[model samples]
Target: MAENGALLRVENLVKSFDGLRAVNNCTLEVRKGCLTGLIGPNGAGKTTLFNLITGFLKPTSGRIHFNGERIDGLPPHLTFRKGIVRTFQVPRELKSMTVLENLMLVPSDQAGERIWNPWLFGFRVSRQERQIYDKALQILEFVDLQHLRDEYASSLSSGQKKLLELARTLMCDPQLILLDEPGAGVNPALMKRLVERLELLCHELGITFFVIEHDMDLITRLCNPVIVMSNGEVIAEGSPEEIKGDERVLEAYLGGQYLAGT
Candidate 1:
């Protein structure tokens, strides 16, 4: 049920490793300013699709577009620069760095990265660093992690690490974000926090999210026009209620997965 005017588009996309097709003829749309959810059974090509969209893997065939520009075959860093970024299921924060430091590191074109820039434009670099730190503090506060800004990422719980990862992603100021199983190990309370933060970001910041989530309740509560996949292809797309009731989905997944959480 993909509609027109999508901010992200996947058209006849395919990926293969050796002789096996991991993603086959996948086509979908992610509209701007929506919190889209992608749900599928294991080996449904969810992560493979994410990798292709994020440019971590070159597609075996087909095309991808973001913000009206072709993005397929671009490198991951180039894709990120085009305002599409992704977060992993396991939070990838730097263990030794403070939460605020982690966020500061995500922004690109930093003045401190080059060797000569430090001496030639040290004052400008310091000013830029200060600005980034201030913004990082604001983002940490927005995600309700300001108090933990100075804490090492390693010391945080599984849930807090996820929160930190989300906050860091914000530093990049992406227009579209692809998230892989954000609630995998989070507790209920922190999961609620993550959802609330995501809602606020979506509405207020106008950030678009395409997430892979296994928690039925979470997806049903947060997403609309939910998309379901099976055998590396999209099999169903509709409201959460409609998807949960789809006969095709039931036959392929929901019938057995209904009792299991993901």
Candidate 2:
């Protein structure tokens, strides 16, 4: 059902704000079942491109295809129903809700959500609620946040909140997940665990990922055929080894920090 084995494709994508092109004639693809990485220096239009793909922003001109269907102008909720979900650089959890509740809220159009349906179909509503609760618990366990399930999301540390964000995405049963800076503020220990879970999701669960991060270490560890963006267009795509040795990549953004890390 995929086009050229690609789950998502963007062709000649462009977005401009008051004549300032934030994403200029960009083109890329996220192949099915691969953990793809998107990297660039600050202001390379990574986040802006994500906004366009996820339907937070409409493109000035371009085509976006998912599962071979044109979906360039769908709203966020509609795009989500197409099984593409995204997480933010800053985790957006409900501060007043427990971690479990946060995951429970992700599924769309629950039978229990309608007041009259819940009253009329009490048994069905209860059964669905129980199933959702169990699934939420399993996801929390996978992200190593099961112990914190009952705690308010506000009580979680920065790393734990990231884990919670990922768990919420899983509840949507997504095929392609765009992660924006999953390693941004996470501690090294938590980051390792998060990486392990992401790998398992890609390899075992057959989920695909498109990630944006400044952490080259995490990018190299988890992504292959990395895509580099500069001034709003893709400039390179290759494995981490190839990318590291690429003169263009080094000169564009990896000049100092990447070499220092190595």
Candidate 3:
């Protein structure tokens, strides 16, 4: 945990489908302004847990608190408005839109979105649109995508798309961002850049991150208080060094035979 207080807490989180539990009584907490890692082998219910926290899926039983307020049953949009945002393993971009347009669309509260705004006050709507455009460009610059701001999202490479997705997440000014496999399909060079940007965002922008990543090296370098899960339950929680040397973690990552030899 960081010196700051707990920003989010999960208590006895449980989720099941067809009588088979995908997430089993998992409990964890994310410290404010800290980077946390969530790791597990295949079928460990990592994504399911994310879905539950982000309100994409409802839990069978559990509680989630953000800034001391209960948020378990809130819808995704409400959770987002409350300063929790999540990115997918695959970048979800509007292929037909420009990168800048994509960023502009991320802000949840749009004044012009109402049907009456244009008809009642066209001038005000235009001014607000310009402001949104300028903000979008600034965010693109922050993500180092300013040069491609006008290009269609479909034209971007996978790494660029991932960066765009991260940029879009920032438009909301999120307090806690949940990244699901940010490096899954990204190239090594761009992956390194992504890690650096994430570090800067936490250190400079004061944003908290709860990352779900399989890349142990990336997790070790970027996150503290790593959480390890196996068979839908948290098996260990500690610093990178402790997790690396843990017997249960090794068993979860490598199988019992390898752990026995170790």
lDDT of 2 by residue, 1-262 (tens): 4568999999999999998888999989999999999998889899999999999999999999999999898989999999999998888899999999999988587898887997799999999999999999999999999999889999999888888888999997899999999998899999999999999999999999999988889998999979998888888899988877778877787464653564
lDDT tens per residue, model 1, 33-91:
99999988889999999999998899999999887778999999999898888889778
List the candidates ranked by lDDT, beginning with the highest: 2, 3, 1
In angstroms, how far off is 69's CA in candidate 3?
A: 0.8
Candidate 2, pairs of clashing residues: none
The TM-score leader among the candidates is 2
lDDT of each: 0.87, 0.90, 0.88
Question: Could you tell me how far off, in angstroms, the CA of residue 191 lies in candidate 3 after the best superposition?
Answer: 1.8
Rank ordering of all candidates by TM-score, starting from the highest: 2, 1, 3
Tell me the spans in candidate 1 whose CA falls farther than 4 Å from its real position. Answer: 1-3, 257-262
How does residue 184 of candidate 1 score in lDDT? Answer: 82
lDDT of 1 at 108: 94
| Displacement of the residue 47 alpha carbon in candidate 3, Å | 0.9
lDDT by residue for model 3 (124-226), tens: 9899889888888888888789999889999999889989989999988899999988878788888888999999999998999999988787888899989
Query: What are the models' TM-scores?
Result: 0.94, 0.97, 0.93
